[model samples]
Each structure stands twice: as structure tokens, then as C-alpha cells.
Target: MKLFQKLTPKALIFWTIGDQAGKVYLGILGNLILIFAIFEPAKINYARVLINS
Candidate 1:
């Protein structure tokens, strides 16, 4: 009911973050690497991708 609806978003966000931690880390790493490799971007590591799936 209303309680379920209220918790849905929090639960979803938690699960999504948990599931995609690696992907997010890799994506950020890739982005930072590409930037440095091509455009001399900053060296940044570790990332948290938010997924709503």
C-alpha cells in the first residue's frame, strides 16, 4: 500500500547502486583514461553509477 510505495524508491536506489558498483567504477575509469589518453584529462579513479533498473 502506501508504505510499499514510500519505500520503493529507496529500495530501488539501494539495489541499483549495489548491483552496478563495478560497472560504474569501470565506466568512470574508462572515461578518465580516455580523456587522459586523448585530451590530457585529469587522473581520476573510482565512481558510483546510479542505476534505476
Candidate 2:
């Protein structure tokens, strides 16, 4: 139970950071596709994002 308590916050923080990073990643990806019409670059990123999510 002590080990679980120690890890819980660390796990929560790690997940929060990961969530924020994914949001920023998708925002950039959206800008590229919408503003620049750059599908090639986003396609690569999209694949990785899909794998992650």
C-alpha cells in the first residue's frame, strides 16, 4: 500500500504531462493541415499520434 501511494501521484503527473503533450502535438498537426495544406508531414505525425492514443 505504501508503494502504491508513492507511485499514484507520479503516475498521475506523468499522465497529465502526456495528455498536455498530445494536445499540443495535435494542435500543431491541425495548423499544418489547415493553414499550410501539408498532408505529408502530418501523415507521419498522424500515424504516431494514432499509435500513442
Candidate 3:
């Protein structure tokens, strides 16, 4: 989807930076928590919206 496509590059950049900065574990954990807390609900809403439209 467009949302994922847009986010992919940004995520990759952040991951690369985090790796180089030696915060890979922290970044990964934070990203996982954020994905579960935020993106999960957003993704469900997006799917609902798409289905409705």
C-alpha cells in the first residue's frame, strides 16, 4: 500500500542510522513496541476505511 511504501524508506533510514549509532537493540525494541501499539490499530482502521470506500 501507499502508506507502507512511504514508510519503508523512512524506516530503512532510521534503522541504518540506529545501527551505525550502536543503538540497534534499543531501536528494534522501540520499533516493535511502536508497531504493536500504534501501527496495528492504524492498519486496522486503514483496512476498514478501504473496505468501506
Candidate 4:
């Protein structure tokens, strides 16, 4: 494709990784939000993002 022709092989690899990651993370995070919203404790009034670092 013309657009793909502009990117180098390494750039194309990273671009694909970024593209797939963007699509996948939304579904995962949406589920996480729902899970946290339903089961989150009533006492803690804070965000529920599960950071794995």
C-alpha cells in the first residue's frame, strides 16, 4: 500500500505494535473499569486503575 511504502521496516513494526496495542487496551481497560465499578469498596473514594509496576 502507498501509506505502508512510506514507513521503513522497523518503523512499520513499531507502528503495527502501537496500532494493535491501542485497540486492545481499550477493551481490557473497559472491562477493568466495569469490574472496579461493580466490586470496588464503598469506603475508598479514589481511582481504581490497576497499575502493574
Candidate 5:
């Protein structure tokens, strides 16, 4: 979670820079990739744990 907290700011900064550079589509794609790679798995694992519990 702490790692995510740190990464969130960095990601936001990068996304902002990308957007300012007129790479909006690429920024959105990158955000989606990050969401799936990081958040989606955590969400699935949390749901599984809740169901098991």
C-alpha cells in the first residue's frame, strides 16, 4: 500500500507530462495497463479472500 501511495504520485506526474506533451491516448493506455497490472489483481485477490472468509 505504501508502495502504491508512492507510485500514485509518480504515475500522476508522468501522466500529466504525457498529456501536456499531447500524447493523451498513450497516457490513457498506460494508465489502463497500470490499473490492470497492479490494481486489478489486488482487487481480485481481495474479493477471493472475502469470499473464502
Candidate 6:
């Protein structure tokens, strides 16, 4: 619990995405990741992902 408290602010700033709309958007992103992982094991293991800020 304390650990979560310490991390909460950082998570809100970097991970929350946004509001209710953002929640749905993140849900879709998570679902797509799950589906891709299940169906594309080789790609998941080998693909290089680069996130641009």
C-alpha cells in the first residue's frame, strides 16, 4: 500500500492516459496486445519496439 502511494503520482502523470475516454482507449490497446501476443509468438519474441516521445 505504501509502495502504491509512492508510485501513484508518477502513474497518474505518465500512465493514466486521460479520462473515461482514455480508459477505453487503453483497454483496446491492452486487448490488441493480448491478441497479438497469443497469435504472433514469434513476432512478440523478436520484434523491436521503439516508442517515440
Q: What tens-digit string does per-residue lDDT give for candidate 1 at 1-53?
A: 87667767879788788779978999999999887797543222222222322
Estimated TM-score for each candidate:
0.39, 0.54, 0.38, 0.51, 0.50, 0.43
Question: Which of the numbered candidates is closest to the native, going by highest TM-score?
Answer: 2
User: For residues 1-53, what per-residue lDDT tens digits would candidate 2 score against the true structure?
Assistant: 77666777879789889999999999999887786666677887999999999
Writing each residue's lDDT as its tens digit, candidate 6 over 1-53 gives 77667776767666555666788989999999999878797665556443321
Question: Every model's Cα RMSD, please?
Answer: 16.5, 13.7, 16.7, 9.8, 15.5, 13.3
Q: Which has the better lDDT: candidate 4, or candidate 5? A: 5
Candidate 3, which segments miss by more than 4 Å at Cα? 1-30
Which residue segments of model 6 deviate by more than 4 Å?
A: 1-18, 42-53
Stretches of candidate 4 off by over 4 Å are: 40-53
TM-score of 1: 0.39
Taken over the whole model, the C-alpha lDDT of each candidate is 0.70, 0.85, 0.85, 0.81, 0.85, 0.73
Candidate with the larger lDDT of 1 and 6: 6
Task: Write one digit per residue (lDDT tens) for candidate 3, span 1-53.
Answer: 77666777779798778777777677888999988998899999999999999
- Identify the superior model by lDDT, candidate 1 or candidate 3: 3
Per-residue lDDT over 14-53 for candidate 5, one digit per residue giving the tens place of the 0 to 100 score: 8778778777777888999988999888999999999999
Off by over 4 Å in 2: 1-7, 38-53
Q: Which pairs of residues collide in candidate 4? A: none
Question: Taking the candidates one at a time, how many backbone clashes does each contain?
Answer: 0, 0, 0, 0, 0, 0
**Clashing residue pairs in candidate 3 (N, C-alpha, C atoms within 3 angstroms):** none
Indicate the TM-score of model 6.
0.43
For residue 52, model 1's alpha carbon misses the true position, in angstroms, by: 52
Pairs clashing in candidate 6? Answer: none
lDDT rank order: 5, 3, 2, 4, 6, 1
> Which whole-number lDDT from 0 to 100 does residue 3 have in model 2?
60
